[model samples]
Target: MLNEMRALTVSELTHQIKQQLEGTFFHCVVEGEISNIAFPASGHVYFSLKDSGASLRVVAWRTQAGKFRELLRQGEKVEIRGSITLYAPRGEYQLVANQVSPQGVGALYAAFEKLKNQLRLEGLFEPFHKKTIPAHPRKIGIITSQSAAALQDVLKTLRLHRPDIETVLYPSLVQGADAPASIVNALNIANTRAEVDVILLVRGGGSIEDLWAFNDEAVARAIFASTIPIISGIGHETDTTIADYVADLRAETPTMAAKLSAVSQDELRQALDLFEMRMTGVVREKVTKYRRYLHRLSLRLQAQQPAHFLKESRQTLGYLSEKLEHLMLKRLSCYQQQLTNYEARLNPRHLVGQQAMLLQQLSGLESRMADAVKRKQTQEEQRFEALVGRLNNLNPLAVLSRGYSAVKSGDQLISSVALVNQGDELTIVLSDGEVIARAETIIPHENSPHNKGI
Candidate 1:
């Protein structure tokens, strides 16, 4: 029976150990530095609790995770109240933490707070010192690890929001002892390049110790001194660093930083659509108004037509002709009356000489009267012809027929180049048709002759 000591499957053995450990350490306490913390979407928390000597795996269920997340940070000393248990799948023992309390702030966090306070006193974080982020950045400079998941997140978000936006990446270390220097060097390079509209200093979420480089004094100073607006996104939403405080804007995550840096293409496209609609409405309104005005003008022109004036002139001429005829008839009647009186007074001997002289004088008077009437009629006809010539010369249509054109901006005549600008739309009225044209260039005359006379 001793030699046949039973062989157990690995899974069975693991299960037994798990049961034994759970029974023995039904409750226990763990103190160590938290590291490699992860909070999954399921709301459970998984992390490593490490000391100088060794490390232990820890897991907190969703119920415990929610209560301790705010208090637990990477590299932070914490006391965990939980039970020891073996995980059969991994064949490892882990602490199932049900309660967690901070032992103290980590050294890196202490330094971060100290520098933040010092910078606050120095006014580095003052609103007045911060640069405003452009609403529509042309280019964004991202400073982070080339292979960082944070960079990928930022890139994906930016592409979704604004596919046309250009992004330039400055790769740098985001963790470890040399990370601070690398970040500072990257900042310097971005400043020297000076090509981006804004800078995004971002990194994936990590424990306090892993994100310590962002809390470095030199990196903070570099951010504070940057001319370009900086948006800092380091670690989780609950995590804060010195760089976050000094940056012009703070984003809880790299994805948020990408959004804050640029306006979405859809938003811009919608704005343009609205503007186009408004402009079209304005142009239509103007066209309607001008059409009404033109109609009124046509009516006025018809009312003052030369054909109507000519008709009135013809009526006046007819009235003058009647008056002339009446005057001539009256003169002839008077002559006849005088002739009759002379006949009544005639003697046989005196009548012969008197009749001959009177006949000659009568003929002369008649001839002079006819000549005066003919001259007056000729003068009237000549004056009418002159008036018709002047009217024809003043006709707008006549001018257009001479290869001259009239240009109008809206309904107003464009009399001078000063009234128009490059790219202005104009309606050119020609002899037979109209042409719509856009001004391509405007050349202002220097010491213009028109200005000189004025």
Candidate 2:
């Protein structure tokens, strides 16, 4: 039977198809690699899941995406469990994922865990095993794909930071199956040459599979054992590989690694200029201080010289000597005036004439005075001569010479008869002769009745 076709709106047709697909698909699990991941500020994740030739769009809202946010990354293999839904407004179909897990990890994760544990026991990730990055590298060797943007970025950054840095590039495969061996050989070559101060293993951002070479055990071990300090700058900011753990420094990008290994020339020049200015200021200050000190010392020296004082003292002595000489000359002139006045007061000629006249008058008076003095002298001379004649007549020697005999007893003369006694020795002197006589009887003076004198 021919039935009339019912008319339906475009919205109705789309709604009906969405409902039917939602009912038929239900919630299911799909495992594939992630591609074209896009995150917007709306807190929603948008990406595609793909196998060999097919891809399905996915949309995980913020509430459901929280669990898988850290685990989801570009090119990572994951299994997602979600409900199939069709957006009516956009007329597009997509999976609204509710949960996610790493693919093949049910069995592989156990083995990974077991190996990680075993390695932990062996101290493969010990901090003591980590090497130190050089502060100022003289030469930097780069291990990267020859055509990569990472190599160009690293070279540009090093030239900007330090133009004097020497850099060499060792080309290698950064992706695919052969990348790990290429990187390991590059590291070995860099170590053997000893020409580079530091080694940088770098590549641009890519999917996890593209960056897998850096996670290889051989590459990680080679990085750890490198003599030169190694810096890993692989993938994007969110990617972390096993090489990151072993490298001496892990930079987010190749440019950042170059900046970390070198210094800026402009900053160094500014510092040197400041230092030179400070040294000049210090030297100038010292010279000024010494100059002022020398000036003060010179003035002090001038004040202390003995020549000025000696000259002043000599001038003073000369003034005093002149004053003494003038005083002596004045006294001599006064003495000369006094001598002239005394000479005028005592005229020698006048005094001598007056003495001559007085001498004539005195001569006339001397005739009378001399006559009186002569008469007095004549009488005194006569008296003196008469006294002499009397003295001569009274002389005992003269009497003895006159033949008058003087009787004496020893040296004494007998003056009275009474002095004579009976039996006394007598000394008699007759003229020039002396005799000693002895008294025979007492004698008396004849003036009395006794006749002793007879």
Candidate 3:
């Protein structure tokens, strides 16, 4: 058989072997831990899958790599499904992965998926559990590595925003096996002291391994349990960790965390200056408006003054006095003319008869005049009594003396139960004193049996 295939070109022999391998392993699934991962600029992932003295070279193109990016990691166990292929240029045989997933997760990414579903069902990521950050925090606590450049960035941003805010640093390891515990301890310390208004857990950006501590369940639980609001600034804007989901706030960076926690002093100063200027302008406008109103009122009052009224009254009185004097003189002249006329008509010897007739007429006139005077006096007395009764009815002092109260709500009278509700504040006016009370209950007039007066 070897002689029958002799003298064949190297390419032909390799092709035959490639064809045999492809037919033998048309479609297969392999499980192993990832090692020697290399992502080249050619947009292909090259890695070796090894487990106990055996390794297979594998290649996943950019298309397949995208789907498995979240689930694949160095040293992580995985299962890959693909077909065997040969590269003619390099004359090498390799497995081309079509689909990749975490090992044994064909049953469903059971462990990862189970934890995600459980946490979601527990409402750990609900919006209602989110706490609002203080608009202006008096103090900020930082949980980070003391030697990290992240600390310096946070401090600088804070100083730029609000210099008066007190910063308390709780030093902790941000990486390595102890990082999760260190972070938890720092959070506990911050809570116990209660000196900080808000806590910020921050770290600089790094590779997935460098940021792995933030994904620890212990750290996530600690962040959730903290009573004080926490802002997490763990990595770059693109990075997300389990701690980021549980934290009250997520900031893009350490500088952003500081900026969010405090208000900018320059901005505040500018705002205050703007407010002061507005108030000054409003007050000045109001004063000018009121002054103009007062000036007009003063002019009107001057025109209506009592002195001007009194002077007009004096001129009217002088005119009435002159007319009264002229009328009196005319009446006296008419009386003298009447007397002369009567003397001409009377006889010199019949003076007694005329005197008797005059006395009778005089007596009749006196009787009529006396009756008119008595009627006038009776009407005047009745009018005076009616006036006195009306004055007594309108008197506020009289009502107060009778121990009656006049309650007022604002400037309005309080007369009905429908006007107020429970917990409404009221001003109660009694005859002797005033009391402020919040209404605890309102016994409706229709519902109260005592109000029936039985």
Q: Quick one: best lDDT, which candidate?
A: 1
| Tens digit per residue, CA lDDT, model 3, 1-454 | 9778659788998999889999999899999999998989988899999999889899998977765665557898988999999887788888899878668656543443455566668777677898889978889999999999999999998887898899999999999999999999999999999999999899998755678788777887788889999999988777677778888999988889888886689878988999999999999999999999999999999988999989989999999999999999999999999999888768665787888899999999999999999999999999999999999989866777698866566677778766666678788777577888787877777666444332
Per-residue error for 326 in candidate 1, Å, reads 11
The residue ranges of model 1 lying beyond 4 angstroms of the native Cα positions read: 1-105, 315-454
Give the alpha-carbon lDDT of every model: 0.89, 0.84, 0.85
Ten residues in sequence with the least summed lDDT for candidate 1? 445-454
Better of 2 and 3 by TM-score: 3
Clashing pairs in model 2?
A: none
lDDT of 2 by residue, 79-115 (tens): 8889899988989889999877778644533544454
Note the residue pairs that clash in candidate 1.
none
Q: Which candidate number maximizes TM-score?
A: 1
Pitting candidate 1 against candidate 3, the one with the higher TM-score is 1
Task: Arrange candidates, best lDDT first.
Answer: 1, 3, 2
Note the residue pairs that clash in candidate 3. none
